[model samples]
Target: MSPHPALSEEERARIDYLVPMDHPFDFRPAPEVPRYPETVRRNALSNHPLLRREAARHHQLPPDLVARLAADDDLGVRGLLAQNHPDTPAPHLLRSFLEYTGPERSHLTSRPNFPTEGAGRLRRPRGP
Candidate 1:
């Protein structure tokens, strides 16, 4: 059986509302930087491991939830944590990315938000 149960359409849609389809990185515009569905905010179970893992991608997921997700075993979620964790939330996991030897490490290097010290290339020029 799949370790993470398949998400239903509605569930996927809810996830999308926070992390848009093409934008992909749990992104926000930096000042308002992260936001999520009201249900996610209000639901007590929002901190459940799966929710924590999914919400970690949003620039806006609360620090507490990010902590919970980091504590989970899902490497993909940690990859999201590496790319997303704006406001400098998870320092250790960010360091761990360099130690990880998987494709997910790309999250740290490729995302525009990665710290300049860790990023390989200069800021990308605008493209059309």
Candidate 2:
């Protein structure tokens, strides 16, 4: 039903845009994202999803960021970081997982790829 008797096709199109569409999904690819250099891109450590995902994909991210993500509040994000980060300290990460509590601990520990350096260290037990 048209809202106005005198509405033209263009006006009707404008009104359609104002009204929410029944289908909320956007199938179109995002337009023109700018490219950043590796140095500038390191700032993506902030918690935005797109930035974080982009940072996770960035090959030049530092080892420190990878190590820091072990304590990230978001387990899934942490897991992604763990999986993607290069040169992660295997023993340190496992120790951090042992220290983690609640759901984060459970999620991190459950990963099959979680570094086993700590386990290897424990098995060797020191002489008195």
Q: Write the per-residue lDDT of candidate 2 for residues 1-128, one digit (tens) a residue.
A: 33343554455445532322232211122225634655224434543333344454443456666655545554434444544444445554465455433333444444455565545653446899
Which lDDT values do the candidates have, in the order given?
0.49, 0.44
The segments of candidate 1 whose C-alpha lies over 4 angstroms from its true place after superposition are 1-38, 41-50, 88-90, 104-128
Question: Candidate 2, TM-score vs. the true structure?
Answer: 0.38
- The best candidate by TM-score is 1
RMSD, model 2, all Cα superposed?
A: 14.7
In model 2, residue pairs whose N, Cα or C atoms come closer than 3 Å (at least 3 residues apart or on different chains), thus clashing, are none
Global Cα lDDT for candidate 2: 0.44
In model 1, the Cα lDDT at residue 51 comes to 52
For model 2, the stretches where C-alpha displacement exceeds 4 angstroms are 1-35, 38-43, 91-128
Clashes of each: 2, 0
